[model samples]
Target chain A: MSILDSIRTALRAIAANRLRSGLTALGLVIGVASVIVLIAVGQGAQQGVQERIRGLGSDLIFVKPAAQTDRSTGARGAQGGGITLTAADADAITEAKIPGVVGIAPQLSFNAQAIAQSQNLGVTIIGTTPSYADVRDARVAQGAFIGADDIDRRSLTIVLGSAVAASLFPDGDAIGQQVRIALGPQGFNFRVLGVMEPRGGTGEQDNYAFIPVSSLSARFQFLRNPRGDISVNQINIRTAPGAKQEPIETAITDVLAQRHQVVTPDFTVQSQNDLVGAAAEVSRTLSILLGSIAGISLIVGGIGTMNIMLVSVTERTREIGIRRAVGARGTDVMRQFVTEAIVLSLVGGLIGTGIGVGVAMGIDGRDISGTAMQTAIQTWSIVLAFGVALLVGLISGSYPAFRAARLDPILALRSE
Target chain B: MIHLENVEKVYRTEAGEVRALDGVSLDVQAGEFIAIMGSSGSGKSTMMNIIGLLDDPTAGTYTLDGADVSKLDDDTRSKLRGRLFGFVFQSYNLVPRMTAVEQVELPLLYQRGTNRRAMALEALDRVGLADRASHQPNQLSGGQQQRVAIARSLVVHPNVILADEPTGALDTRTSEEVMGIFGNLAREQRITVVVVTHESNIADFTNRTVRMRDGLIISDERRLQVIPSSASSPDASIPVSEVGS
Candidate 1:
């Protein structure tokens, strides 16, 4: 018989048992949909990490002292093992004139309470140089940030982060207003200089108040270490536009090691690109792991298709006899059953792709457990899913089709 | 023309070898209407299967239209069967989901260079079921279903029609109606017709009857064609040579 005639015959048979066919296809639909959704979610998470890294500037790097333990209670470096990084070290790194180095800011933070009028709130007081704004991607929304003159004169001028400014001055502006900040047993009044633009994410910089390192050193004597050194907890570095951070990182590490006179310096220097690359790699692995787990279901769906096809062959023994009696070849019978399987999977694949994409889009940009998830359904993933469905159909249908083709016409005819 | 010489079929089951056909020889000419009469296990069906090319004889020489087809392969035998013979079964063997027209068009699918739909319709018309072309097997009566099977056999324009108990499941009136269509095809269209049955009354309608018992032909005789008049009224009466009754 002609191939088209065989396909038409198979279609008629499939239509005869519509509910069974739909149920068989449902397994494949769920299989492909799960694969698509998981991959999209994984890809979205990777993209989210990249965007966050871009927001912090790609060429930026952070240097932190290994001895600086205990984040909430400020640097406990002296108790841990004695302080290593200081304001002088930060100056030496900048004055060494490292290539690709655009700016550097030394940072020291302490938890304190700010009282404005009758309103009192606890906040982290971040002491840094004027270069902190550029290095940390912090933009001043209201007034100016702490300038060089503010540091040189050891002025009591401060910049408020968006959240801190919102909480302390809920009714009006906090610029040029006096606020008393108590550090340990001493209280000092500082004037607000500017309010920073909101940076949305889970970062310590988002809930802090910015001040000059010189002001913190001169005004807060209790912030010093036991060895009388002004210990800086972290140092932020910015590279020039289009500059490579790898070579600069190596150079900075070499300079710090040489200046410290220690063979194994107790600090860590990490570029923003390194962080982004690591996160992306982790997400790609997760995507494959999840996709493969869902792929098992697709195979199970194929098995279901095979099982149904075998049942169909058994049920249609007399029909097979009829076709053979009508002079249909063995190949014709085989083609008919195989074509039916492919059609079933093709239809199921299409439906699954639609549902998967719809679900992915519905959950895009939604927050799940404090992390805003982003889902992106790629075209290649859909194509791959559809291809897998077709393959599964062919593989699963082969045995049944072979069995149908090999049926003895005489015996089949004799069967009721 | 069909010829079988010393045809023997031995089926090997777990019980042992059962000789279904033993040294049976038969010949049929074109345009001949013949009946093979035998009880169950009398080898009439085995002989029919051998002649129909659906089974290979253990020892035999079968020639159809000047070609030896007994030793042909599965694919070649299928092709030869499509071109040379049409089959009708006692159960009517109509595919459940297909309409009468589609069932009739089935054999034509295996034969190349044929106008399928038009030929199928014409075949249905010839069986006197032109109005029921769209009816499924379930919707048709037993007699109508047999007619559809007859139409399917006729659509391929084969040289011979091989029927196995064609009216075994039908009432006496329906059986007569089905036999009327076969009589018309053999006489008017010059087609050879073979029917295997255990009923003597059913054998009476054919021009010849061959009775089998225990895998051997016990008797073969010629008879006058007894075409029922009222059921096949639309077909013009054809000349039949009267022989020994």
Candidate 2:
């Protein structure tokens, strides 16, 4: 038979059992839909993390304490322990005049309970210099940030993060208001100077209360390190425009090693690229894992389709014999069965894509944790899913079609 | 024209080997209406299968027209069958979903041709079934369904028509009606017709009869021809063309 005639024959056979054909296609539909939805969610999560990391500025570097690895005992200290980073290190790095040195901001923070006139809440209290706002690309939405005069005078003044302001005074203004912070039995009252611009959907950076470093050091002497100097937790560094990062990182490592009187540095420095790369690696692994899990369902669906096709071939043995008698070759019979299988999968795949895309669009919003959980479906994923479905149809239909083709025409004709 | 020389067909089963056609030879000329008559297990069906090219003879030279078709490939044999022979079964074997016209269009679908609709309609007209062309098999009577099958056979314009127990599923009246159609096809259209049956009355409509016993033909005879009554009826009004195919 001609190819068109074979297709027509296949369509007629499928139309004869509409309900059975629909049920057979259900497995494939679920398989393809799950694959699309899972990949979309995985890619969206990966992109969100990468975008947040990029918001930290491309030329930025972070320096923090590294845990000590003991050679003799073969045991490791707690993470971010061993050596303490202090404001003196920040000053010394600034004094060395490194080639790509631009600006440096040192900060120390601890969780504390804040008390207002009628509200009480747990908040992160940060002690940093005025240069922090510029270094971290933070903008003051109202009033002003901690100034240099306030630091020199050791003034008890504070700036609130957007979230902190919203919770402390839900119905009124927060600037010029007074709030008391208690850290380790030491209570201090500070004036709220300003509120930071809202950074919605950011996990941690959107909810901190900032104070000048000199004021926190004077009021809270317990913060002094074992070496008898006020210590800072981390240092944020920025590079000059068009400057290479490798040379600058090497220079910082050398300067810190010499100042600390150690052959190896006590701190770890991570560039923005390294951070983004790590995050991207995690997202890629998650995407692959989810895609493979969904692929298993598609395979199971294909197997179900094959089972139905075999039953169909057996049920139509007499029809096959008739076609054979009327001049149909073995290949003609095989083609008709294969075409039926392909049509089943192709139709199911299309319907699945529609459902997947609709579900993805329905849940396109950030979750309660302020991390976006929305899906982003790529064009290539849709195409790949559809192509894989077609391939599955062809593979699963082969054995049954081959069996039908090999039946003896004489015996087939004798079948009722 | 058809010729079979010492044809042998042996079938192997778990019980043993059984020879269905053991060195049977026969000849059928163009425009000849013949009946292959035999009792149960007399190899009449096997002979029909071999003559229809649906099975291969183990030791034989079967020639159709001028070509030796005994050793032809399966696809080539199928092509020749489609072009030169038509078949009708006892069950009528019409596809359940197809209408009468679609059933007739099936054989021509395998060949390179145009005007398929017109040809299918013309074949249905020849069987006096042009008005019932839109009816499915379930909607037609047993005799009408068999006439549809005959129309399908005629659509291919084959040189020979092979019918296996064509009237075995019909009543006395329907069987006579089917036999009359076959008679008109042989005499008026000059097409060869071969029928396989065990009934003596069914065999009387044909011009020749070959009787088989065990696995071989024991008698071959040419009886006096009896013109079917349908040829004289008013319903046999199919147009006669001046050109012959």
Candidate 3:
């Protein structure tokens, strides 16, 4: 029989028992769909992170404590260690006059509830210099930022993010207003100096309340390092326009290392490209993990296909015998059964691909709770899913087809 | 013409060797209608299997039309079977979901023959089933199903039609009806018909009866007339050899 004839015959046979065929195909359909959907999710997450990093502004670098790897004991210290960087380090970097350095903003933030009379909302209270507005690409929408005088005087002054400003005082004018920021049982009132412009970037830029680092050390006495300097959690560094970030980061690292009397700096500098690359690496691993997990289901679906084919071959023993009796060659019988299996998987694969693409598109740009889910349906994923399904069908069908083809005509005919 | 020379078939068992057919020789001419008769395990089935090319004999040669068919390869054997033999079974053996026309087209389908639907219809018409061509097996009665099977056998234009207890599952009326079709096929179409059965009454419908006992044929003789004569029976006055094959 030709391939077409075999397919027709297989279709008829499958149609004779519709429920079983549908059930058999369902496994593969689910298998392919999940693989595509999950990989799209991973891709979306990666893109989301990269976009947020870019949103923080281009040509930027941030500093944190380096993870310390001890050679003798072979033990390592976790990153962002205690007092990794302080006001002293920032002062030393600024004094070093590192070329291409545009601005520096050292920050230490604490999560606190902000109470503007009756209206209260939980927000992070950030302690940073006035240059934070320029270095991090933040701008004032209503009033001025925390000026140099505010830091020198250690004044209780606050800058509200657009979202926080709107939440605290919905009546428009939030400037020069008094708001109490409470850390645990202690609360302090600050004059709102400015409201930041609406800059969407992973929700952080819109939610934080900015304060001077010196005021934070005075308000929370325990924030000072053992060396009697204000502790800084992170320091934001901006580079000159059209300048490379690598040299500035290297210079800062050198200055910090020398001041700390160490061969390598106690802090680590991460540039924009480094952060994007890191996010991509993490996301790629997630995609592969999700893909393989989905692949296991595909394999299971393949096994399910084999199971259905074997049952079909057994159930149609007499039918095989009848065909053999009528002059069907063994190869014809083999081809017919194998074709049946392939058709089952092929149908399932097509359906799964359709549903997968549909689900991915359906979930794309949709708001889940509060966050919008982003998805990118990849062409390779669809192609790979379909190709694997056909291959699975071919592999799973061979054994059963062989069994059918090798049956003795007399015995097969005799079977009920 | 068909020929067999001292054919022997032995099946090995875990306990010992059991001879199913031993030194049996039989010849069936073209256009001849014959019956092979014996009790169960009497070697009649084994001989029929050998003659139908479904089994190989332990020793001896079987010739069909002029070729030594016993040593043929599977593909050639399948081709020869498609071209030369048709099978009718006790239970009809019609695929359950296929229409009568499609069932008839089965033999030609394996041969990859063209104009299959038209040829299948013509074959069905031969057994007066052309009107019921699209009816599945479940939609037809047992006798009609058997007739459809006969049409399937005829669609290939086989040189020989072999039936293994073809009427084993049919009633008296359907059995006679089927046997009549076989008789008409042999005498009128000049096609060979071989039926295997233990029933002496079924044997009366054929031209010759060969009885087997313990792996050996003890009797081979001619039946003078087709019994239960009806208007559709072949003309009794004509000699079997006078019919052109």
Q: Taking the tens digit of each residue's C-alpha lDDT, what string does model 2 give over A1-416?
A: 67787778777888889898888888788888888888998898888888889777668877777778899998988756654688888888899998887888888888898888888878998889898897788889999999999888989999998888888888758999998998877999999999998866554666789998778878897776767655777788888866887787888778777887887778877777788999999999999998998899889889988999899889888888887888777887788889888888888899888987877776668563775576889787788878888888887778788888888888888898
The DockQ-derived docking category for candidate 1 is medium
Sort the candidates on lDDT, descending order. 3, 1, 2
Candidate 2, residue A379: the lDDT equals 80
lDDT of each: 0.85, 0.84, 0.87
Of 2 and 3, the candidate ranking higher by TM-score: 2
Off-target runs (Cα >4 Å) in candidate 1 are: A67-84, A109-125, A152-157, A163-172, A178-190, A200-208, A214-223, B224-245
Best by lDDT: 3
| After superposition, candidate 3 runs with Cα above 4 Å error | A66-78, A225-228, A240-248, A362-375, B223-245
How should the candidates be ordered by DockQ, best one leading?
A: 1, 3, 2
- lDDT by residue (A159-261, candidate 3, tens digit) is 9999999999999899999999888767899999999999886777799999989998888766767677888978888888878888888898888888778
In Å, residue A59's CA in model 1 sits off its true spot by 1.2
Between candidates 1 and 2, name the one with more favorable lDDT. Answer: 1
At residue A17, give the lDDT of candidate 2. Answer: 90
Per-model TM-score of chain B: 0.92, 0.92, 0.91
Residue pairs with clashing backbones, model 1 = none
The digit string of per-residue lDDT tens for model 1 on A1-416 reads 66777677767877899999998888889888878888898888778777777777657887777665667987556522444678777888898899999999888877899888888889999999888888877899999899999989989999988888888898869899988889779989999999998887645456789988888878888666666556787878999988998888888888888888878777778888888888889988988887897799889889999999999899999988888888888887888899989888888898988888999898897888986778889787888888998899898888899999999988888888
lDDT (Cα, 0-100) at A136 in candidate 2? 81
